[model samples]
Target: MKLSINQLRALEAVVRTGSFSAAAKELGISQPSVSNHLLALEKHYCAQLIHRNGRLAEPTELCSEVLSRIRSVLAMTREVEQILEGRKQLQTGTIRLGYSTYQFALPVISKFMEQYPDVNIEARAMASHDLMPLLQDGNFDVAFISAKSPPPEVNAFEMRIEQMVAVVGKEHPLAQFEMLQWKQLADLPLIQREKSSETRRVFEANAIKAGISLKTVLALGSWGSIVTSVQSGMGVGIAMAGEVTELDNLVAIPIDDNELTVSHFLICLPEMQHIASIQAIFDIASQ
Candidate 1:
């Protein structure tokens, strides 16, 4: 008969416990069953694998080689079991997703939720920097982060490759213009997101080049809030172009003669790819 898993385990038990009776007892089988398994292994290998003198059984030269081979097979089996266990953990698991802004995350989360009905994903909004600790502590499965401060611990993949836009109140004189410069924006009241956001980071950097600071008439918590406030004659909110879907009530003016790109990333542990559910989500998003 061909060698089998039971045969391998029986061999391992025999080698570890040093006797057929002990191995059989450990495996909850009879001593005769253990001897039968060892004989089957020896027959499969076409080599004598045991030595017996009355009540004692010892490993022969070929038996030592057989033990080594059995150990290798057992090691591979254990690795496969561990891999399968990991996949099971992923299929019915929890994902703690940390996000910087809802403007980027809401749609991604909506799509992911629909795709992975089994994987329960929880989302928490925090500053990009604040989310790092949760990811480091293993509290988070992944993070949608940007203006990413490179940490040696987390793995990041750019997901949403997007560009920034300049919004203007419909009545604002700037709405009449096709393109404008940073100096031109300084003359108008600019609505800014909270200081920690990637959008503001680029805005401030650009303002510095123009020898101007972001002259904010308002600082808001969310991009939608800023957009709505801007529509009500508050001020122009700087945001991504794709986010302005309902602009019938407002105007999204592209930055004048300049382009600003903001890309959001999907971050996770490097080994998360081995997880089937996580890999499934990643694959769907990638497509």
Candidate 2:
């Protein structure tokens, strides 16, 4: 039986997203088109690929068996396209990169652009946790992250080290100090990032070493939320010193421990490390 790439993609998207409508939105096509692809695919194989489960679509047993192969085919297809494009050298191409922090990534990207003006760079700032899953899914070519460990699927090139700092409102009691000792933060209400944040993980590790349980009064999911909470006198916040910007009514004081530094890593799929465009970027970053 013969199957088209679009038909295979439609099946994968529908199975992954759990609904034809959701798959349509992801593929940037009409819902009817997604349905048509599936219809043709099933007719060609003379087998049902999907069955309705309430409002969602679940892949049949037959479809499930072939899903892995489909994903591999699509991945290789993209690789072939990249190889073909790489024949033109680094003069023209797109680098889709995700990042955990902008402070570090922006400068690197700025330098990269100056050297290769024709190359397109799409950079997005997202949480380190979110960036890794997307990278594993082939959504990003590379990522800039500050974390304790890189994911197993990707290789990391250590860039620089950064330390965490305690942030407080200008009028807060802790604001009087130039630098904060770890013990001082024990009793204070802390505005912390959610459990998934690398900043929080590093700060917590330090707090544990200081023999004090961190008193996290608020757990915010984003940096903006922590900033707002700290600014409004909700509690003190912790962040990497370089990552903190726009501190109008707040002060970011250094934490006492030197070991609280997080290492910034340039992460990408292991196989992609040798690509000319990606290597050029790594070379620039290494300089």
Candidate 3:
């Protein structure tokens, strides 16, 4: 059976937009044209691809499988465009990256920028959970995540490992110590990153394992806010050693327990990993 790219794109738009009309609007065609495309695809495959429920078309199992392949095709199509652009000029193109906890990936991006001055770079810093959906939507080409394991859909390369440290205000008594035990945190009110952050998850998991429950005084969404709160003497905060900066009023002390090193992973959709810009960034990271 033969299928056209238009048919696959129409099906993908229908599923992604949840209706033929929306797909038509996205494709700049009429609804009937979108329907015809799907009809032709179903005829070629000899299987129903969608089940209409009022205004929405839900994918059948066959369509579900086809959608996955279509995404791969679309991604490859984008990669082909990138390849063509690169052939025109190897020194120019854009690399869109998403990252959680900026400090872990900053040095590599800096070096990458220095090496490829003409390449355009866009970076977004967000919670690990928030970045994945953006990555799936193709808003980002790659993401740097702090997690023990990346989701199964992506190819993940371990970039760095950092042990969690206790950050306290310089005025706080704990500031004098070069190292502190996890159990010592039992008495300090904690300033933690929001629940969606991987740093918070890793710290909380190890905190439980060590039989310590944090007395959280504030839960801030951004790392900067958490650090500011710590500086204000609101409470102690947990952070990776590399993540803490602007230390004029704060200090990071190593935790005596060694089980809390958060692994930083560079993640991208497996299909897009071979793109030149990503490979260049990955090479810099591997160094």
Q: Give each model a TM-score.
A: 0.63, 0.72, 0.85
- How far residue 76's Cα lies from its native spot in candidate 3, in Å, is 2.1
Q: Specify the highest-TM-score model's number.
A: 3
lDDT by candidate, in order shown: 0.70, 0.81, 0.83
Candidate 3, residues 78-141: lDDT per residue as tens digits? 5567668767533767888988877777898999999988788999888888889888765788
Alpha carbon lDDT at 83, candidate 1: 52
Model 1 misplaced regions, further than 4 Å = 1-91, 148-153, 257-259
Error of model 3, residue 168, in angstroms: 1.6
Estimate the lDDT of model 1.
0.70
Ranking by TM-score: 3, 2, 1
By lDDT, highest first, what's the ranking? Answer: 3, 2, 1
For lDDT, candidate 1 versus 3, the one ahead is: 3
Reference-based lDDT, residue 274, model 2: 63
Better of 2 and 3 by lDDT: 3
Best by lDDT: 3
